[model samples]
Target chain A: MSEHQYPASLTHGLSREEILNRLHNRLDEPRYEHCLRVEATAIELAKRFDQDVDRAGLAGLLHDYGKEIPVETYKRVIIEDGFDPDLLQYGRGVWHGVVGVHFIQTEVGITDKQVLTAIARHTTGDPEMTKLDEIIFVGDFIEPARSLPVEAKARKAAETNLEEASRIELENTLTYLIDARKLVFPKTLLTYNAFLTKE
Target chain B: MSEHQYPASLTHGLSREEILNRLHNRLDEPRYEHCLRVEATAIELAKRFDQDVDRAGLAGLLHDYGKEIPVETYKRVIIEDGFDPDLLQYGRGVWHGVVGVHFIQTEVGITDKQVLTAIARHTTGDPEMTKLDEIIFVGDFIEPARSLPVEAKARKAAETNLEEASRIELENTLTYLIDARKLVFPKTLLTYNAFLTKE
Candidate 1:
């Protein structure tokens, strides 16, 4: 798809350029750009945290792979894959990250369990998260294009402390959901409590 | 306890006077006073919503019956009674309502299912709550002695709409929990989402 060739280091089964091409076809311009920023952000975090930068970048780039998939498709995947039936009540805002992992593994040819887990948890974090998961989660929140004041604070925290950045981002998200009277996915609260109680 | 005799209509298996004596023996002065205020508040809300005032009064008065029990006792009950083991992680703040129903049934001698269910859900509300559950939950938040500005607002809302009041109280509780960096019981979020999406 893209004329560009990606380095082999960043390739997870499929070449990075091939992944970008699929993303371009699937995502609108803005969402595609967001994935790029998240990839860059996650790469920086991975470097700082001593994780595999290539894996982080790959995971971040394809994190929202299923973001633009049709709702009907996601519903069918949820049932067929034996995903939680309760997920049907939520729309793309939640499904894009959770059920999206299916598309990432099968369509994009990324077989790394860690990468898929990070993407699956990007929208609603898990009670126990790996370092890659934290990087992607915070990277998505504090991407350069994000201008929220809370995002700015989280970005500052991400510079030195990934866990603190995650905490701020998670708390801000919960606050926004509660204030707006939006339906909160249960796992988000579980993630919040687990992180806090662990400290 | 005192030289006070409670009305016969408000008795649920146990006489009101006997219940008061047990409460006085178990709870400290402040908690005992809170229970009385909650009872009055629940009664007022019941009258406004045309629910049974006696049931509301009884449920409210005994809602916090386990609040004063030792943490060890609550832990034992959580295990022996087959309560969710995850509940062990939370303190009296959550246990006093959910696991307290057992104590309400056995020790307090209250057998009304509606009354027990209301008390059971007073701390972390259920996804599908009865009118009595809303009454006790809101009563605990908007009781006359509660002076927090949010509580006052919830009290005002309770005067006309129980659902709105419960929403306000739940949101306020969530906000407080997030701000305080406290561990949240997952059911609280479930209750909140269930209420909002139902409307």
Candidate 2:
């Protein structure tokens, strides 16, 4: 793949076709399909929430770009990027979103801070998420491929009340993590606290 | 109430009768009964875990001493004692444990830091909970009057593995708070993280 296969600009102005082409080469077919669904869901959410649809779509398309990387390579990227050292204690499930930021910046040449923040926090969520952040976060959870029992209610809630939908999704995710005996990254708790207290 | 009704010394050598007398005057009948159940549960856990039964019982008896105080009085105590200002943002559900420490210290004259820390953290756990802290925290949840479905599993786990019991209790509490749309105190998250990463 030539360097031109990726976006040439930092503003994330690439069309959907160009973004898909780049993602297609980087991810296998099934994973690539998930990204497309996430992008479509994110755009719908953005429209409902009055956020910039283009940035949401871009964030969704590129959210899991680092998931395909080798674990050792992701570890190196996490250290080189100067993320919180405590992040090293978690596994790939938590690392992908964080390490994805560095991968997108270096490999995909997408540097929009809002887009980067959305990608960085898409999986676990940050305490202070913007409307765009909520769009991508909720969209990734309720995307078409997801089949959790709560997804239908979450999708409906997303259309009517984004904050409530986000809160429910966070609660569901934290419950799953605890039941599975997996480590929960601290930012997920911070995000839950933020939504729990929101007006 | 007479001054002798409260503990006159810092060592917490007050007899169970004395403690019950003080609690009876301060709390209503049902609340006072709940404290008695907690004390009983705590002593049983302490025996299983090889901790000080007397200290655990004292911590349990005084755990909710501030619960009966008026909300405005607890708020005043919180600020006057220089507790975390962020505590002001949370409602009474989160205040009583924190403000109770000051009331216990000033009114009851019990200055043992371990007992105070256990009382302060009983409602929402601290990250660095000792065996004694775990006894009180789990005991309060699995006490007889508490009939939550998870409490039985938690009680059994407390007898076998205190850490596992504490983790289960925290997960149950956090899930309940989230489902009820209540604000989760940050320390609760810290305790969850600590347990998630423990061996």
Candidate 3:
């Protein structure tokens, strides 16, 4: 109910326990481990791209916090958290990201809009990614698990430029989505189109 | 390769076997039976609404003739049959109707543009269905075997007015598609939008 605040880079140097203490029962063990990996990778990739490693790590750590909520609970939270009705069409697997932004605003108590957007679009992906969002998104993909055959090569690409690595990662993910008979989230398509249309 | 030609209705009521003769090897027994039901239903609805009953019946009978082909083969047929690729994303369920129109036009030798369009839009259920197309489209839905609870009421409504009956039928179908998680064919949405906007 308070003004939607997003604390971008909230608790940047906080240890895993410290981060968990703030999020309360919202954190699950396996997902918490994944968040740590995403955060670690984001920092590593940020170093290669000459960006703020701490901010990128912070974005990654919180990107999927909303997903940790149960699916039925996620729907209730989306309504209670206040999101657009069109977002409901995103179905269960992707609805978490939509609700997650609201979670951060209402529950996690963050106030930075850009950081919230990065986490909001972590799953659906946006056409225009802020530098922090791009780093977090790419870092999560190349995180220790998920090990696709080209993971190492893509991770190496991240060193030179996070944007370039993201373009590759997004293309791979889209192709996989098509093969998987999954819904092509419009935001992902828009993001792909965005990059293609960019100078 | 042949010139477009639509099937003509029989002077004597056509038997299922007579209808099957117009189609080639791909027309199976169950589908053929469905076509007969659709044709019969279309004829009855057209008579009640004072539309072109013969055109309605013929279009209904041939609406799905192209469906049994493999997706790759159907995609080729669809593109070659004059469907734009952008309009072809409703999946293979819709591809058949496109191919069926071409079959009617070129192979069967039905040259009437209205009849061709009726066949084309039967599965898709266009918004601005011609007098002929509306009868065929609505008939396919409220046909005798229709198990849906609303079909009987919709069938009776067709007796009062074809266009009004079609509006209800299309809204019902659209709701069903959304509820069932099937993609609403773009043509159907465009048609629905056109009617809503214009009316």
Candidate 4:
């Protein structure tokens, strides 16, 4: 409770490719490439933040690891596997994220808490954004390949101050999700909220 | 994904006492008691479904294990734990159910995927529930302690037809969450939505 208390998946030091190989074809070719792009973006942010590039890259690379399952299977797996299916029903598809973290650690045998924590949190980026977690999150949405108008500013911030860049990217992400009437993953808002307070 | 993968923390298999002990120290004393009561409720539901009461009981007892964290910590852990905060902001406090599964397996080391899944989905029972998952979910909400006008009927359904009873319970629970201005966890609604399609 004092620090980030996590198990193997959250902390193991798996490289991006190692994590991708561990994905074991869960993702199709396109999604895998997207993850690879996200990992690259995350690495850029990591350099800016002076964070662990490997951890950030891995987190970005594996953010959607559980997403390969059809939405229906998500619920089925949660029920059959004995997880809460409600997570699958809602916004930003967190059940996969939650389940992905577990799968990576237990099934894949990666035990680096930092890497897992980054993956666990990249979607909603927590209040206390560890350098790596923030990088992976912002990098996910604003990587060079992304075509968002906000990316330019986000890119600029990443080159200067990472926390500020993450804050901007997260707020923008929340705005997009909210405007879309999408289920705003609370952590995204929480990340935004936390950023607001910090700023 | 094919056979339902769970982590070693989840598959380790814990005794009821160990489960309670973990909950007792981490959660409010009353909530701990609620867990025990849910176990009994789950046992009765197991009877209705002709499922394994012991596994149902264990799942019921630990459904809200993550609820033990103080609100601040719960907020932080779940968000930092990687759940999209957008999901949380929808006013669904029920996330602990999903988050609980992750915690039990990763941190607590109870690895039975089914057990963790059952606990995760208990708040918003899934549609394709395992015989065991359904039993435990029904038990958690309608346990002898819950006080609702339809509680008696729900209990009887556990005796007569579990699937039917679950359909009713899920309906009422979703309505209650909606009425209370709470965000419905998608998985719960998916379960409810899926059941709505069936007989």
Candidate 5:
């Protein structure tokens, strides 16, 4: 419960409590708790990486805003919003982030482009991630609730170099998706190539 | 050495000995032997599946025709042939199959559409596979020389059902590629979806 407490300064137009309340209304219990952990972790990462802690916290809190939406709604929003047609081939797992942007824009009224981009890319990261983007992405992967073996190394890496940590996290995620025989989104490939081939 | 001997009846247009001589001249020793084993396995599969044995044999023999080509040549051929622009991002590992069809046509003069298609798809299979294509693809994976444990199951499956064997073989290959952190060709995903999600 103490972890749910947010800093007074961490507000993107709406109070932290208001954002959490909105997210709670949309997500189930476990997902809501995960979002809280991601927010705390993203704030910490942002501090270490010299990014805007408030922006990172907001982005993490709302990243999965569209997760609980009905599949039909997601399909409708994707077409109505003019999202890439290729995304239709993938299932709801990949669509939530894409649909989350529109949801946050209309419902949450958080018009910060950086926050919106981070939310849209939280699931399958984009090739060019801002520092805040890296913080939220790495934080989401290494949040305290997650039990991945690489969590310790990733956390340590984030403290010194968030981009390196983000690369490792994306590599591990791509490997896991492949191992599970899941369909890989093309954007995930672009992200992987961008990270690995970076100078 | 005995494996190098092809049945006289297994010739497409060129004599079996002539085809082997041309293949042997172009391929290194191990590659040449692998091609022979694939041809033998393909012929057996073709017989069991009631496909054209000669076409399968020819396809298997020439499947890797572009493998030994210089990387520069592969790149040049890919561009000249107007292959999917996305293919350039992958290395020669994925390009050999795309370039092989052109090579087989001009260099070896094997103009049989079925044989050429089989060769083109031998690396990363197509969504729509003919019986001959399945024979060559499965034969290349479960050839006598391959030490993979799945080889036995695949060969056995091929005896009873070629398409089923192809699905198993493709699944295993995709898993291995993921394990190795290799870049997966898009066609491989299409082929996987085609088989796994077939009605």
Candidate 6:
């Protein structure tokens, strides 16, 4: 509601209220609320992981900035901005992170690379994730509103081992996608493989 | 074994006996035996699927031709022959099929494009596979000696629907790779995603 609600460390040109206004402009009510919950969860995770809490909050809040964009717009931006041509084959489940960074940067006026990269990788994780990235990733999944069965275990794991929580979340996401016959963006698999503990 | 051990229709210049000899020379005894089992399984699948039994048998018999090639050699051939450079990152699990097609063509002297494509796709399947490709793919999984728990279910699926069998096999393979923290070739995920039943 106010500037203090956001992390003081998140000092970009726009106030936290302005960033929320931009998110509200793009996302429907429920999606906007999810972003707030993710922001809260990310701050908690940032504390446990010893990362910048304000940055994590900012990254989480803005992660889904492009979630409501039209498919045609994502396609147009992907082609015009020279994003991977292969990205055209997938939709919002993937584009919101891989392509959404563009929107978060230009629209929200956020310039921090850590926050940007964290948002970019929130949907489909990367082969190597920073501690900040892990916080937003785990926070988004374990945020109180997410009711998936894996959420309980991931939240519990987040209390102790962040990486383990991420592995649980990634595994659950991939399993659901495969079972539902959904098209999986390849980076999800890459992230899954990279996160697995070698046996 | 006698000449009748092979189907009468498999006319690829070299006799089936010569193919067996070549396999024996390159593969360890167990690997060579697996190929024979795959050949038999493929033939049985061919009969069920209304495909040419002899071609399926030949494709199955030679599918793993490059499986035993040294990693160094797989790398060298992948480079020298202008194969997909990405093949260099994966080991025998991938190279044996994608890169092995070249060996089957040159060393084994098998010229059937269908057969070569089947071999090329056996390990990591394509987005669109011919019926012959599906046969070899399922055949190699349901072969009698594969003792993994999923084998029985996959074998049963092969009896009624070869595509279902391939799906089960792909799912099992992917689960194992992810659980074991092994590097999975990207195409394997592509095949798995493409094969899932739409819900």
Q: Write the per-residue lDDT of candidate 6 for residues A1-199, one digit (tens) a residue.
A: 2133654445565777777788999999999999999988898888887898788888888888999999999999999999999999889988999899898878777778889999999999998888899899999999998887789999998998999999988888777777666777788898887886422
Candidate 3 residue-wise lDDT, A75-138, digit = tens: 6766765677666645755775656777667665665676677777777778678777887778
DockQ of 6: 0.45
- Full candidate order by lDDT, most accurate first: 1, 6, 2, 5, 3, 4
- What is model 5's native contact fraction? 0.07
Best by lDDT: 1
lDDT of 4 by residue, B1-199 (tens): 0112223344365544565567787778788788778876776666656776556766777787877555665567667878767555533256677666777776667777777777777766776777777777677657777778777778777677777677778767655543343444556655755664455
How close is chain B to the truth by TM-score, in each candidate? 0.92, 0.90, 0.79, 0.81, 0.89, 0.92
Error of 5 at B153 (Å): 4.0
List the DockQ of the predictions in order. 0.88, 0.59, 0.04, 0.02, 0.23, 0.45
Q: Lowest-scoring 10 consecutive residues by lDDT in candidate 5 chain A?
A: A1-10
Instruction: Report the lDDT tens digits of candidate 2 across residue range A78-155.
Output: 788787878888877777787778878877678889898988888888898888998988998899778877987888
Q: What is the lDDT of residue A183 in candidate 6?
A: 76
Give lDDT tens digits, candidate 1, residues B1-199: 2223345644544576788888788789999999998998888889999998878888888888999889999999899888889998899999888888888777767777888899989999989998889999999998888998999999898878899999998898899999999988888898998779554
lDDT per residue for candidate 3 within B35-76, as digits (tens), equals 778878777777776777666766777777776767777667
User: Higher-TM-score candidate among 1 and 3?
Assistant: 1
Q: What RMSD does each model have against the real structure? A: 3.2, 4.0, 11.8, 17.3, 3.6, 4.2
Docking class of 5: incorrect
**Model 6 stretches astray by more than 4 angstroms:** A1-13, A21-31, A68-89, A99-113, A144-149, A152-164, A196-199, B1-12, B28-30, B69-88, B102-107, B144-149, B196-199
Interface root-mean-square deviation, each candidate: 0.5, 1.6, 12.4, 9.1, 3.2, 2.1
Of the true interface contacts, each candidate retains a share of 1.00, 0.62, 0.00, 0.00, 0.07, 0.48
TM-score of 2: 0.89
Candidate 6: lDDT of B123? 92
Q: Could you give candidate 4's per-residue lDDT for residues A1-199 as a string of tens digits?
A: 0111223344454443455576757888777777778877776667766777656666776777877666665566667876665565563356656666766766567667787777777766776877777777777767667776688888877787777677667656654543343455555544555665464
- Candidate 6 structure, TM-score to reference: 0.79
Candidate 2: clashing residue pairs, number: 0
